[model samples]
Target: MFYEIVTSPCYGTVEKVAIDKDSRIYEWEPLFAIKNMNGELEVIKMGCSGEVQSLEVEAGDKVIPGMVLAYIQEDILIGGSD
Candidate 1:
């Protein structure tokens, strides 16, 4: 198992948090809602399915491009120790 970091793609304020710690998330699932600088709302989605390990930001938090939003823990099937 390994962790994947979820990052923000724009400068905005977090409008809503869609998942909680330890929650399971699916690919393309909504993770957060952010209101961008131009007052446009953007819904951020998960790129891969995994269990949420931690959340780095919350609703109402300010975020910039490439900022970390959460950590996701996923199983890697290619290599494993039995």
Candidate 2:
């Protein structure tokens, strides 16, 4: 029923992509691995269970905090909606 965009938690360069577009991912699933400025791998996690709509960044791409990496589509059950 809504979309959730996954973002980088800190300034870093995208090191790896663990998921692809149209991929179904669960809560806390790793979306990407980023190498921080201090040379650390930070694994970004999905906050909700949904289907990946798109990937906005690729491996070796620079990123900053709040930079969107991918979009997730999650269905919200309404009150007896048709």
Candidate 3:
């Protein structure tokens, strides 16, 4: 099953894509800054606080729902033997 992650609070552009499966970190990067509710600009590191499987799109990609931007490789075995 694939999930769609929306852009939170609306921002300029996506800087990077982070992938995480089953609470395990797979990839990460520094994302572009976004203006919060308080009107403050802030750059958020992708997947800094939550478990993400994979990013659907890339940097500067216009995104919408029902779009298969990226994919998550599920069923990864432990001990790095997949």
Candidate 4:
């Protein structure tokens, strides 16, 4: 599955990118973090295990809540269900 990861609810400027494209990451892993307009840090986490497919935002980029940050292509589990 192609999964999209968005920024946290707190609007902010991207302070850092914790992962890179094609990087393998586990579920709940830290994908990226943003520094809110209020100077608070917000971390966006991966919801599933997968390889990073793309990154839409970079460090120092301005971002808002729910902004697309990156894409993750989740591992396929074939024959796992009937």
Question: Best lDDT goes to which candidate?
Answer: 1
TM-score, prediction 1: 0.88
Q: Which should have the higher TM-score, number 2 or number 4? A: 2
Clashing pairs in 2: 1-74, 1-75
Q: Where does candidate 3 clash, by residue pair?
A: 56-69, 56-70
**Model 3: per-residue lDDT, tens digit, 30-53?**
333444445565444434333456
- At residue 6, give the lDDT of candidate 1: 90
Error at 31, model 2, angstroms: 0.8
Report the error of model 3 at residue 64, Å.
0.7
Which residue runs of candidate 1 sit more than 4 Å off their true CA positions?
Answer: 77-82
Model 3: runs farther than 4 Å from truth?
Answer: 1-15, 20-56, 76-82
Runs in model 2 lying further than 4 Å from the true structure: 77-82
Task: Summarize candidate 4's per-residue lDDT along 1-82 as a digit string, tens digits.
Answer: 5565655577788888988889898878877888888788877786688888888989898887677888788886678666
Candidate 1 per-residue lDDT, tens place, 1-82, comes to: 7898999989999999999999999989999999999999999996688899999999999999999999999755677778
Q: What TM value does model 2 have?
A: 0.89
**Model 4 steric clash pairs:** none
Cα lDDT for residue 40, candidate 2: 96
Question: Candidate 4, which ten residues in sequence have the lowest lDDT sum?
Answer: 1-10
Reference-based TM-score of each model: 0.88, 0.89, 0.31, 0.82
Alpha-carbon deviation at 55 in model 3, angstroms: 6.2
Worst 10 residues of 2 by lDDT: 73-82
lDDT of 2 by residue, 1-82 (tens): 6999899999999999999899899888888999999999999996688898999999999999999999899756568756
| Candidate 3: residue 49 lDDT (0-100) | 35
